[model samples]
Target: MSEPPASDLTARARLRMAALRLFAERGFEATSTRAIAAEADVSHALLRHHFGSKDGLRRAVDDDALSAFDRILAEFDAPATRQGLLATFGTVTARLFGADELRRNYLRRSLLEGGAASGELFTRLLNGTRARLAMLSEGGDVETGAIPDSEAESDRLWEPYQVLFLMLGPMLLEPVMRHTLADPVFAPEALHDRSAANQRLLTRGLRAAPGDTREP
Candidate 1:
């Protein structure tokens, strides 16, 4: 297909940004193409012509977000030691969770209302991140390793999921944790500190596990 004009591309980008913000604020089921179009100040026909449908637009947003995350994560070279792994993970977690308020809001909305799409995106992100972690953990034991490549493929596959869940738990549970906990400590800044602490604990535990000979 011939390349769309630059103006069209710009419009598509605007629509995607507008849709993402609106969806994050109002949710997927509640947000409409017309509303997104209006927010972007573009014609409804332009949105349809560019994205084909709301689902298409959502997928595009998901893809772009993930791609951007990947790009940011590419900066850190994988680490071999458990401490290094934790530090690496912490760095990445900080970047992902430290996104601007708007993006974080949108991501929260996606997690809440995007259903299968969100799950798929989460799976993809986890798997990709796990692979990187595994690569980083080369030469380390399954128990002590950051990613445990020696484990069964099924177990190995879950590493990224575990890491992601751990990283995302604070963001996902902040509301409930804040409500139920007497002294709430789930704020983003606090989560970052806790994540670092958890990583240190994980590294120590891993190093202490039976059959693990890795030195501190």
Candidate 2:
């Protein structure tokens, strides 16, 4: 397909595209505004005009990555049944694995290269997930027994973030996880199946059975 004309693109789009390429290649900390500007073929003033600062640009990148995931939550306000929750959860998990290359690399770097640079982004992302979970619970998405009485409300809140991290294994572990699973164990086309499996377990709650020793 032919590409869209440059005239059809916004300054923010250009800057974001430049930032994604530069950050993925150079890491967020190492990439400078000047370098991004040069890559985008735009003046530094334009970057400032649109994103305000490097931090602002990085926030935009994270928001762009999360936008799709957030949209699923928005679409199904209450997710009234277990199946609804599972299906929605499945979609969210799939997005993490199937995210666009730029988003995948940017988030991988932000999460693995953790420091002050990514702290704000992860915090914001987690908090948003928690808020959405709260909404779901309030809307009756969660049924009793889905979570045990012994677990604190705080622990329940972190469940979605835990799932988020697990689904990101492809980026965090790279070839190691792929090699460990191998093609036979987890076929390349089984990404959605893997995501569905995660949702099934996650939606089932964290209560341990008699021999369970997984909890810290």
Candidate 3:
């Protein structure tokens, strides 16, 4: 297949970004094609030429946002020990969420809105978490007996969900968190601190030491 012209790629990116911003701020149901086009400073006809419609633009945005998670998961090409996996996940999560406010907000909105696209994104994250946990378990990084009975009874079924929540809970509750804490949670300093704290929790949970009784 022939690649699109450079101008076409640029326009498509602009339109997708515009749509992402609007969707995050005003929501999919309320954002309009013309409004997105105007935000992009492109004509409505140009947006249609690139993305077909508002829904198409949204799908593009979702794909773009989800692609980051895909890249993060791909970083685990080789199985890592429990501490190694936690460190990698913490670094990537901080980098991903701290880099772009708009992208972060878009993801938060998508997850909170709950739709087909949102479900797909959440499923992808959850599946990725499970895969990483499996890698640790299979690599003998996680001692099965060390896991608490509450988590191990169901074969550690809820571990993935817990990990996912620790990773994304701030994004989902940013507004309330900011208000309550009186700080921008995604700010670089705060994000780094949050990542470190989350990694500590994971480290405690996945520690394989025989006598360490630290709670995660």
- Badly placed stretches (over 4 Å) of model 3 are 1-9, 76-91, 131-156, 205-216
Clashing residue pairs found in predicted model 2: none
Q: Measured by TM-score, how close is model 1 to the native structure?
A: 0.74
Looking at model 2, residue 188 earns an lDDT score of 44
Error of 2 at 107 (Å): 0.5
Best to worst by lDDT, what's the order?
3, 1, 2
Write model 3 residue lDDT over 33-141, tens digit each, in one string. Answer: 9999998888999999988887788879978877776666556533234444555565666567766678788888888888787798788778877887777577545
Could you tell me every candidate's TM-score relative to the true structure? 0.74, 0.74, 0.73
By lDDT, is 1 or 3 better? 3
Let me know the TM-score candidate 3 reaches against the reference structure: 0.73
Number of the candidate with higher lDDT, 1 or 2: 1
Clashing pairs in 3: none
lDDT of every model, 2 decimals = 0.69, 0.66, 0.72
